[model samples]
Target: MKKYRAVVIDGKKLIRRGIAVMTLAVVAALGVLDIKIAAPKINVMPDSIGQSAVAESVPVIGAVSGTAEKLKSSAIAVVKKVVSFVLTFDPFDLHTAVAEELPLIKAVGYGYLARTANQSIAAYNPQNVDTGGGTAEPATPGTGQYPITEVDSGQGKALGKEKSKILIRNETDFGINIDEMLSSPLKFDMKGEEPKVLIVHTHTTECYSPEGASVYSADKSDRSLNADENMTAVGKAVKRVFEKKGIKVIHDATVHDNPSFNGSYENSRKTVEKYKAKYPGIAVVLDLHRDAFIYDDGSKAKFVTEIDGKKTAQLMLVVGTNGGGLDHPNWRENMKLALKLQNHISKKYPSLMRGVNLRKERFNGHVALGSMIIEVGSSGNTLSEAVRGAELAAAEISDFLNTLK
Candidate 1:
């Protein structure tokens, strides 16, 4: 009898070891696949303190990496749908479906089932999912595609080499006011030690795509809130340009979108207000953000154009109006500044500026008449492109602001 018990114990031990080995093998396979979620990174600049440095690239994973990521995402979506359907039945409301301890058992069973389902779903779906662009809006030319309302067709210097016109589609229902904003020649007097321009980022974590990398992040949501590595790096580039031009700028490298995505605008507003209070000479408050343009066919849209023999990402000027139930009366002033800068950029860089975008949100533009949001580039662009774009923008903006009288 003792010999028989020992044999049974040995058999049980062998089964346990086999199960452990299988579990380890599955984990090893997943590690090899290196599946990533499909979140694209957005770019933005932050605070300053140096010359614009060239960006370095990291090698991207093989094609299998992306495929595994998509497969896992689809399986989760399917399981979520099934779970939602089961929850709608509300079995708890029916006494027929309940027993003495069935409620507790059902809760425990559902928890375990979800955990098991998540673990068992293999990252190998045969179906092809459009993971690239997803449902991102395309960079469709014409005014309706962007958030803008051209109030006035400002004077242009008769189009430089290969003149670019601001494309606008007047079919939208947005109100347009053609106010003569150019009252006097814009000029700025060199003030005391106070900063001339204040730069801040609401989405301080937005980062550009790395060169030679398939995606910016291994996870689907491609964003890094690192102030030194992401948007703040771009901001520093801009600050370097301004400093080179002898324009004093205050680049606030605060990460507003850190713990929460919401209330970023509010946080940035406080930052702007604080700086404005400290530096009364701050003439312009720039909220720097990077734009994202993804094509409808799940492909990233490229907004790069050759400027001065360097591949530079296009820059967009976003000016907000008080149309969206916001009490911003000085939006026209901001628009005027935007128009002037747009005209200057179009003339200087030709195709570098993607025209000025007018939006309904205040975007904290009420902070100052010179306040505006500058979108450097999209996720499809590299850090080098964005940094170069910011430098070019800073030069143009410095020239324009200096002429403010």
Candidate 2:
């Protein structure tokens, strides 16, 4: 009997060990398989941080000694740091790790210049990428396969090569700016009784700005701050909104102070997951965020609305375009929703938007069909304006979800 017991124990240990290996292997696989990490944009645009979401021939970071050595000295060192930042599987704290290594981003300046010079040389070489003719125009709205309003014809010099570098740097340095970059891109009208959809107010940008905790109002502690951590508050707010509607909501608003980048999303993703586990019936998941586009003069973008004149915030729809396994369809469906919302707000409230942006990237939108992101205002914008915008957007969202079938 004792021998049998010992054997059982040994078998259990092996199983546990195997589980550990498999778990790690899966994470690495996800990383290689392009497990998308939606980097927060400074201007409300959701950037794609890890193009590598799944495992591939690429060596597991810090796996072999030689690989570690190579990473310790390669340009990919930044890549590894970013991966570590997104994965959060490390001895180093994500924020502190990135903060401590701000130099890495600054160093990229030289690389950028060198690359720009090279590109210039290539352009002159005549065999390179064709800058030929005038720029192509965007397809008319509702003209595409989808039934949505048209995006502005504004294209071209706005997305120049140099601007691309700045954008890349911004994505690496900060995740995504919830307020400024992504103009509201949701469409739906919930004028009356409808199922209550929830928008989780998360901490994308660090709460404490240079001024104070105005736009920085969050509840982050020693523990990580994501939308989940503040589910209590989220639940309460959602409950408050849905009290009369006979609807219960799962809110994931963790007012933790962090930069509105990947960290915020990371924290929020876990929180939403936990909430979903608790309440499986959840249909819509809205990530309510503010932006951070401070002008050189310190003023933020503002829009005059029926409520009052406030800093204008941009809203974006971050949908998972990855149709790969685990990736969801109808990701573009959110685009339709976003456009409707943006148009409604524009008609009812002018200057409340820079415009809605369509990011090819996904910011966890694949989790559900009702998933979408909304950015209010930027760092230069007042917290009061942002709060007002949040409330307004909430109203619009609530109204819109009521219409969702």
Write model 1 residue lDDT over 168-248, tens digit each, in one string.
212123654423444444434546677878999987876666664443221233357556557898999998888888788
Estimate the overall C-alpha local distance difference test score of candidate 1. 0.57
Each model's C-alpha lDDT? 0.57, 0.39
lDDT of 1 at 230: 70
- Candidate 2, residues 1-405: lDDT per residue as tens digits? 010000113565455445545555554654455333333333321333331332123434322223333433332344545545444333134544442233222222333311111111112424322111111111111111221111211111233442211111111112334333235443333333433355575443222122222322111121224323222322344345554444445554464334332234446666777776765556677765443322222222232233454432333333333322223466555555555555455444433444444333345565555676554444333344445555555555555555453
